[model samples]
Target chain A: MTDVASKEQKLSAEENISSKILTIYLIWSVIISVSIIIVGTILFIVTGKSGYNMENLNSLITAKGSLSTYPFYIQSIWSGVLTLKPFAIIQLGVLILLLTPFGRMLLQVFIFLYEKDTTFAIIALVVFAILLFSLYMVNILEALHIA
Target chain B: MIYIVIGYLMEILVASIAAGIIGALGGLGGGVLIVPFLTLYFHVPISLAIGASIVSVIATSSGSAAAYVRDKISNIRIGTFLVLFTTTGAILGAFIEHITPVKVLFFIFGIVLIISVIPMLKKIGEEVPNVERNDPLAEKLGLYGEYYDSVLKREVKYKVTGVKPGAAMMFMAGTISGLLGIGSGAFKVLAMDLAMRLPIKVSTTTSNFMIGVTAAASAGIYFFTGDVNPFIAAPVAIGVLLGAIIGTKILVRIRSSSVRKIFAVIILIVGLEMILRGAGVI
Candidate 1:
């Protein structure tokens, strides 16, 4: 099913670290996505229909505030898991993942450059530039709240 | 319960497809297309709609990014640096929602969206095929690049600079995404074309490409908070996913220059609706 010929044609004779690393990253991403879906499903079943509404969510957030400043052990070992609000945790995760493309893109560039393939590097760069600019726009709009 | 789950699943399927197509071709988040419908027709809460849209954005990004990287359409180095700032901004913006009033936020969101589309409309008529120089600015900053357009069947090369304005514009795009859950597609295009002076095709492709990652980052938070009610978001996501796919296929054949006007008009109407709603005039 995989494009073996195309893959072989792209990869040079050298043992390129960038391509190897990227392959690892892609594998990890798939694993993480699947695991999260599974875990989330289990949590949904365990939680049942109890207190999933907005009111409970607000309470969860408030509880987080109270528990956040506890000592390292309490905050990390107990409160972080037990009172750890989903919104706060999920928001941090999603946003961090959102920035993954930038890193992924950088990895692509390093691979292309290592292969001495200027053409692919150029294309990768163009796409990266657009991402950068789009990011810049997001920053400005948020700061100004001009909507 | 079973019916609700089935219905929700169906909605997400549709939304995912629509977001994927629009994200691939039109270079915008599928969420922008989904949220308004959810809030207006489905009577879903705005917060929940935003959350679902965020998830779809991440999905779209993942789908497209993998393909684009394989096709050599995305640039990693530049994309990486930009994310450093956008992610920070997204984290901060998500928290800001806690402080801002819902109505006021939407009003501002509607206004900014309208303003963002105007410049795109203005540039639609001019199709200049020229690359700026790879001078000290482009070389030192490492912004020179190229892409192959399947439609045009040609390689397009480009040079770009103006990092300051581009970064500044990204800040605005991040804010809009956090506020409206739309991923601010047009604003992203504007920053690349206007500030960095990249080709329109390149700008659209990259913007279309990176939005998913940005959306995913925020989606995680919404999911943990239980803001993502699959029921409401499912229908909206499905409808938009279908709509966007249809829109993208048609967009290629139709004159997008003129469509920009239509899009602008739609946003204007929506803006007025939002204003009326905000003012209790509805």
Candidate 2:
């Protein structure tokens, strides 16, 4: 509601024309991610199970830790999706949600370049670089055992 | 067996919905409500709870940011410019989160949540934002914009000052986002409203625009660290997103004055509980 208070305000042609691509993209990304999550949840319900084992969850509460010990990567989720594993489907949705903003930064780079706004393009690129670095930096460190 | 599963998932879903409603009504955020709920009632691990909370934060933000950005009330130049510091701090904060003890993280989250309640209590002063001489950096960068305010029924144009200080505060905001797995919009709005002195509407909208990007910086880190458990995150994200959508639909119909006060009190209580949880006093 903090930001939504401004929702009913009308946008001028200038504002509307410039931001159309991004506005549509953001809405779709949220829609797609949320829908996927819903599908995953339904799959979980029908099967009376999740991609994760009930035993794992039970153990998690008792162990005072987490159920996910496997190395974090996309391949596992892909394979799980191939089998229609419910929780894996959920993870795929989560992955999309995670990517939405990163993708926004990527989209902004193109938007800026298209507009020939060199300053903003560079700024977007810098933010993109930082976001990319944030996503993969820890992975890089762990791969080298430097972390 | 199916009913049992339904009931279990429903419990999380419903609690998340309640949190979402309160968050939406109060103009607060879900992460502050959720982390404590998951930890205290659901008994989820602190790390997993944070991971889930951050994911839901993105869900709620994306929906609102879409509207703000599309309206162009959010200044792309200023938002992206500040994002540099936020993303940088987010990366640093995520790494720090890995090293800090869970108890310490819990304690910090509690303190942050309590402090966040202050601005909400103050009632966002709709009075015009502070006007200052535009800094050369802001002028060069074009950190200025105008938006039509529906209530004021006029277009308000504004310039900002103190770019360096504002950027410094954004860095801290980003660090808090990465560290706590929350948006830290309070700090962000503080930086812009009190420090940078942008118009209130612009400050709030731009803060919305930046939150998703900032959270993504740390969320990606959480994903890679295996802190993002699908079971917890899936339900929480879905529930909060749905709840927020529902809240917005009813938002215009409801009077939020009394509701905001109640929710603020609830946030204070949750903050205390999180602190006690970290201190092992409860």
Candidate 3:
């Protein structure tokens, strides 16, 4: 009975710590995303159009476009970050939002390792790897010249 | 020109806010409403609409997940285990989206929405199931959790079962999410509520948590493809995030049965509309 009690205590303690961290991460991610989006929106309004053409919204739609050209945006993303364009800042916000879960998984990996929970650590690691692969699949494919 | 741009932004913002609220209340996530609205009303291309919707899903999922976690309602373990399958499925689904026709995607979306409502309709007014038997899979994976229900004023403990089947269903859910650029919350809830026999609250919260990772998996592909328009996605993300925050607050106070019925009716309408659009009848 004592063993079960201690186990439950440990689990709750772990949950408490992780939940606190997750809450902070979630709040910060939202703030950062919203801030960037607001700044981007303001800049977009002032500039009348960011790098992309807004006058003719129809041309911007890529529904029937070739899939091979999809990675072209990544180049702009790099330049946008380097130059600090409002559009790129907005894109960066979206990227950050997408990466938030990935960040949580990374934190879980560390937490699990610190707790010496090998099973969960491995699981978290696998999740982290899959997310990394998905995020970088375009670069990988390009490196392999498969696309 | 400035007025025109502002007008467009306001429209996207309002629509996204509505989608976010409805999505959080329904546990379906924001993508379902945002995608249909952008495509049907604004004449936004399917790919861009989908890209924007996926981004909004991340926003809604993360914003609400924080509240759910703090409340101790979301099952982190189950969500983590399922991510392994859902993420893999999402990647495959993203590739498939590249070749799929827009009309076909709409048809599938409509079909999925309609089918998911059936389970919700059947379970209306039903009490949460009590699972007395222990499944070996759940035991091995440590897939059980306890949360205090403020509405009921008691602690609810739930043990998950049918791990294999739930995981399989999650893969399909992830596939749909990735292909359609929506949070496949309906199917995720189904897999947990039915296959795993979890409580509805646990199922919904866990599904919400899992959605961020699932959408993230496909979002990268969409981003690289230049399908994510900054102009549309930015406002949508901000609006949905705000709406999701409000929805989460309401979720904790509302009865689960009412939420289910409302979710069913909303999905039923959206499903019919999508079908009509896809069939070129409207």
Off by over 4 Å in 3: A60-75, A81-84, A139-147
lDDT (Cα, tens digit) per residue for candidate 2, span B1-282: 567557767888898888776655443346768888888898888778878888988887787777667556678889899999988998888788877898898899889878867865776444456565788999998787787765566787898898999999999999998888877766777688778988655765687678888889998888877788777787889888777667645543544345446666887898898899889997
Native interface contacts kept by each candidate, as a fraction:
0.02, 0.67, 0.65
DockQ of each: 0.09, 0.46, 0.54
Candidate 1 structure quality by residue, lDDT tens digits, B1-282: 534544544554564565445544556766655665455544455676676676656545554444455445455545544544454455455556545786776676667656876777677755434655654545764666666655556776777777677777877776677657766676777777788777665665567554654554444444434455433433343344445545555544544355455565555565566556556565
> Which candidate comes out best when scored by DockQ?
3
Q: Candidate 2, which segments miss by more than 4 Å at Cα? A: A1-14, A60-71, A140-147, B24-29, B119-126, B247-264
Candidate 1 segments exceeding 4 Å error: A1-147, B1-24, B128-131, B134-136, B223-226, B230-272
Q: What ranking of all candidate models by TM-score puts the best one first? A: 3, 2, 1
Candidate 1 is scored at a TM of: 0.65
Considering the two chains of model 2, state its CAPRI-style docking category.
acceptable
> What TM-score do all the candidates reach, one by one?
0.65, 0.88, 0.94
Better of 1 and 3 by DockQ: 3
Residue B7 accuracy (lDDT) in model 1: 52
TM-score for chain B considered on its own, for each of the candidates: 0.82, 0.88, 0.98
- Model 3, B1-282: lDDT tens digits are 567767888888988888888889877678988888988888888888888899999989988988888989888889989989999999888877877888988888789889999988887775567888758988987888888888888998877788999999999999999989999999999999889999898999999989999999999888776778777888889888877877877888899998898778888898888899899887
